[model samples]
Target: MTTLICTLQDHRDDVNWCAFSGNLLATCSGDKTLRVYSTSDFSELAFSPLSGHGYSVHCCCFSACGQFLASCSTDATVVIWSMVSGEIEAVLEHPGRSPVRICALSPDSVHLVSGASDGTLALWDFPSKQLCRTGTVNEATLVACSFSPCSQVFVTGSTYGDLRLWDLEMRQLHAEKNAHDLGVTCCTFAPSILSGGQVVQFRLASCGQDSQLKIWAINKFNFGGYKMHLLHTLTGQSAPVLSCAYSSDGQLLVSGSVDKTVTVYDANNALLLYTLNQHERYVTACCFSPTAPIIATGSMDKTVNIWRLEDGCRGRDGKSVPEQSALTSSEGRKKIYLPIHLCIS
Candidate 1:
């Protein structure tokens, strides 16, 4: 069951995105500010509203180790902050002064990459802050970029709906495709664990303005190579889907939409597990906590909502929750829905 724990309203403008690092939640906003909060009490941290950007802060991401944070802005610069001190450690200047719409750190935390509005991707040597390489996948702007779990590959989603996977070590294309009808807004990867712990598959999830969500099996066991295969498509959203993420255990998937609703899915079977409608405006961003069952969402309504599922994979006493047939109700499109295990407490 999912319950709204609290609503955080620290930003003066629209919160662009929210990310979790350990037990702390960091949020960036159009007001050109960044804030950190404790996931436990939803209280503002001492080093909140960390201001350095001269323009709208588009996104913020934490390094895999949670020791550093990287944030990009319309000011054409990416700022790397030391999590140890909550202070800016370095500033990376983007070429051509293009808006650095998104930035992500490689999983190994050795390289920092930034995606610009002009459709270019640049890699920086994290230690020295030197531009190592810059390249373009295509002509359209890259809207989202993230590194794989192994850090050997990275994926990019374009404003033209282009999805491309590149081998970071080899600097070669692994796969490419037109993933959706509209611009792809987000792309996330999670491990697909086989039953009885046989094999682990890499899966990719993507969403966009098309009001659809897709899961793709990225690495094939049959072919013994990396190739994307359509796994399933989840629909029921009436508006464009904006963002998505997988739980730390990869047992659940969550998405936020322009329809002002957040939905959680059973990742194993692609079942609609919960539809949360608590935000008053467009849900611009959503993410799962690093080590918990909590989901955090940021909205244009200038608030952040945290929803948690207790005993995520098991029932109250450690046994698995018994499954029943899907429920049918007359609420139609106007009502929010949740599974039997869902709760408001």
Candidate 2:
């Protein structure tokens, strides 16, 4: 069963994004600040509500080892902060001075990519904090980006309803046009990689303004050719899907939507497992813990809800059967709900 552990109501404005590192939870907001909390107790860190960005902080991501965090802002820059000291480590200015909508760190922490409102993407050398290259996607406003498990390539989704793959050299390897009907909001790569013979495969989950969540299979062949194929389209949420994430084990997927609900799914089979309806406003962001059975979801209501999966609550192939889940709201009231299934298109 999934249980609502606690709710963090610290952000003053809409929570734009939420992320979980090994032991910490980081949340960004339209209030122009970022907050850090301890995953163990969901308490705000002493130096939290980090005030460095001049404008709304759109997205934040942790380094592979969780030593540092990078946040992008409408101020046209990405700020890197030291997780231990909670101080600014570096500030990366976008090449064209356009508002940065999203940023992501490579799995190996060797590279960083930041996307701008003007469709420009800057690839940076993480260690040196130097800009290596820059590229653009026509006139599309880039919104979503994620790195593959192997860290050699990354995927980017945009307001143009396309998902593009790029290598470390800032070269566009492949593009999936019209992947979503409307704009893409968020995309994430599964943590694990599948390898067989000369082919390597990776799974990706992306949600969009089309009110659909999609699973994609990205494959790399021996001849250095790449291909992308649609695996499944989930139409569980009635409203536009905003954010989606894959569990650390790649066994489960979670998404938050404009319908004020959060949905959890069996990632392997694209089966809906749970639909959490506690947010009073649009659910804007969702993330899975890298080291625990925990989820952090942010909403337009300016709160971040933390959920925990019971020790034995596994889906699909697991032996335990999920009957119901309980939610403990911030007001100390409890609510329970039965799981609802959704169709896979």
Candidate 3:
């Protein structure tokens, strides 16, 4: 096993989100800057300094086509940038008192959804540069928001433990429920392709301040309504699970935690694998590489570590051994490569 193959150090403040577009990586930080890096050599490619946000950047994402970058900050503004020119294309701001907590762009890049600290969710049309609709969630502060893969629906999770689904076209609430015991910090919908041939069997995963990870299967009941049933409850992390991501194949789930580790689990509730003591501090973000079998995790320790999916294979003593010498160097970095087959079950 090897440690991080590359390390990019440009953010002086807390790095909140790290996203990839092909071989390019985009990162947003409290330093009031958005940076783009080449994943091949971990070299800095472009630096766009943004100064409108008065507070820390909470989240950032790249559009599906990799042509635009969207970011939200505690200053309550969502800024959209053109990747080609590195210019701010649009700035979506709330009135005077709202603080934007999370933002997500639709797959088509025509619509954007954002949640605010005031428990309000807003939908914006990118082409028209206008707010299309707004709805009050009637809960505590909203923490996380996600758009469905189909781009027709969006969901927001609140600090009050409520998860509400909204239909973008009708601008009405489709479903609402208390999905967790503690405040939800992050939530994501599984890819539609992962459901096999069942279009209605959708899965949603959420993690909260309670340090528990829960997976729900949303299925239609006999005659009229939809029901959410808990499919799995993952335990063992000593701290809150701050972020989670599903593999492109949808067979594996990876989560970063305040416990200073990243845990990997199968689609079922089974514990397929885990990586401990990687970061010296809390892991703030994690994501699977778009093309490689790599998972990148950013930490409060001010560094990002890339772990190979093949690192889960164990030796005779039940310890994962380095499968390759690719990461062994005099730089004093650590690497663990477990075979990918161990995580498929």
Candidate 4:
């Protein structure tokens, strides 16, 4: 069973992305602000609604230790903020001053990558905040990027429907052309790595405008050869899929779509488990809590819904069970029951 525990209607414009650290939940919006909340009570932090971006903030991510946050915007800069005091630490501008579409930090928080609308990618040494290397994909707008579990390699997806693998020096290691028709919206690597004998394998999930969510297997051989293979293609949504993410255990996968729905799947078997329809507008972003069986979804309706998943999974009739719900706003917390239906698949 899934329960809607909290609803946050704080953003004045469309919410673009939502990310969760160990204890904090950060959400960015087209309102040119980022808001941070406490996972324990879903309360807004004192220094939240961080208004540091000159334009719409496209994406935001927290460092591994949750001490810092990085946000990229159409202002053509990636701003780093201190999580402790909510102060600006550094602002790294894009090379061509093009709008930044995405940004990601390595799992180890040693490296940070920012992708621009002009096809330029800038890699930075996180500790010192120094630009390390710059690369570009010809005539493509970079939208999605993620680093492997080993943190030695990263993958990028572009609006040209291609997925390119890169090494630490920003060299192209391999490329998969036409991976998604239309355009790729988001991609992420599983947090776990598999090693058996001489082969190391990694799993990746990507969603696109073609209304498809794909799972892939990337293998690294002992001889240093790298290969990518398509594993599963999921078509649970009727509209373009916008965002996807893997659970901390790598056992569950979740995705949001323009169909105004969120789908949860069993990652191992590629079976659709639950279909959640709560958002009134396009579901733009979805994220799983790192320490709990909770999900935070942001939408074009300018609201973030926080859902809690109970133990076990099974098909059930779509019905509403009364539960205590709290909504946080600038005024105060309001008590109400926001009935959220979950359709078993």
All predictions: root-mean-square deviation over Cα? 6.9, 5.2, 4.9, 4.0
Give the Å error, residue 186, model 3.
0.4
Locate the minimum summed-lDDT window of 10 residues in model 3.
312-321
Segments of candidate 3 deviating more than 4 angstroms: 1-3, 48-52, 95-97, 169-177, 194-199, 220-225, 311-345
The per-residue C-alpha lDDT of model 4 at residue 287 equals: 91
Write candidate 4's Cα lDDT for 112-199 as tens digits: 9999999999999999999999999997999999999888999999999999999999989889999999989999999999999999
Worst window of 10 by summed lDDT in candidate 4: 336-345
Ranking by lDDT: 2, 4, 1, 3
TM-scores for all predictions: 0.86, 0.93, 0.84, 0.92
Where does candidate 4 stray beyond 4 Å? 312-345
Pairs of residues at least 3 apart in sequence or in different chains that clash in candidate 1: 1-342, 1-343
Model 4: lDDT equals 0.88
Tally clashing residue pairs in candidate 4. Answer: 0
What is the per-residue lDDT of model 1 for residues 239-272, given as tens digits with 9 covering 90 to 100? 9998888888887888999999888887778877
Q: Candidate 2: which stretches are off by over 4 Å?
A: 311-313, 316-345
Candidate 3 lDDT, 18-98, residue by residue in tens: 777666677777777777765565556654554556788888888888888888888888988887878888889954458
**Candidate number with greatest lDDT:** 2
Alpha-carbon lDDT of model 3: 0.69
